[model samples]
Target: MKRYGSIIGVKPEKLEEYKKLHVAVWPEVLAKIKECNIRNYSIYYKDGMLYSYYEYIGDNYEKDMQKMAADPTTQEWWKLTDPCQQPVENRAPGEWWAAMEEVFHMD
Candidate 1:
């Protein structure tokens, strides 16, 4: 499995709303994520910065991501969550969340 981490900025005021939405994530979206080979996913927030971590167990990462993005349920979920997030200034073009560099690891 490959581990990935990403960072995004959450508007301070919308933190509560974002937490509320995640407290009961949609079943379909969760299913789709698992179907796409995503596991052990978690999001953390601190000082307006949100960090997302997940492990990809599939061979085709791009394809799986595309499939997930195409799902209507995931699309709807994004509509609600996207607005609450902002890409960090250093994020590359076409990236909503700044990809984080892995500095240390143990397994």
Candidate 2:
């Protein structure tokens, strides 16, 4: 499995709405994530930033991501959550959340 981490800024005014949405994530969205070979997925909030961490078990990361992106359910989910997030400065082209480098790891 490969570990992935990313960060995006959350709108302070919409923090509550964002938290509420996560409290009961849609079942279809969760299934789509697992379907794409993403495991141990979690999103954390701190100081207006949302940090996401997940493990990818798929052989083709790009292809799996593309699959996820193409899902209609996932697209609908993004329509709601995307508004509450702001892409971090310096993110790579086409990145909604800035990818984070793993400087060190254990286990």
> Which residue pairs collide, candidate 1?
none
Q: For candidate 1, what is the lDDT?
A: 0.95
Off by over 4 Å in 2: none
Residues 1-107 of candidate 2 have per-residue lDDT tens digits of 99999999999988999999999999999999999999999999999999999999989999999999999999999999999998998999999999999898898
List clash counts for every candidate, in order: 0, 0
| TM-score per candidate | 0.97, 0.97
List per-candidate RMSD values in Å: 0.6, 0.6
Error of 2 at 49 (Å): 0.5
**Deviation from native of the Cα of residue 93 in model 1, angstroms:** 1.2
- Across residues 1-107, which tens digit of lDDT does each residue of candidate 1 receive? 99999999998888999999999999999999999999999999999999999999999999999999999999999999999998899898999989999999898
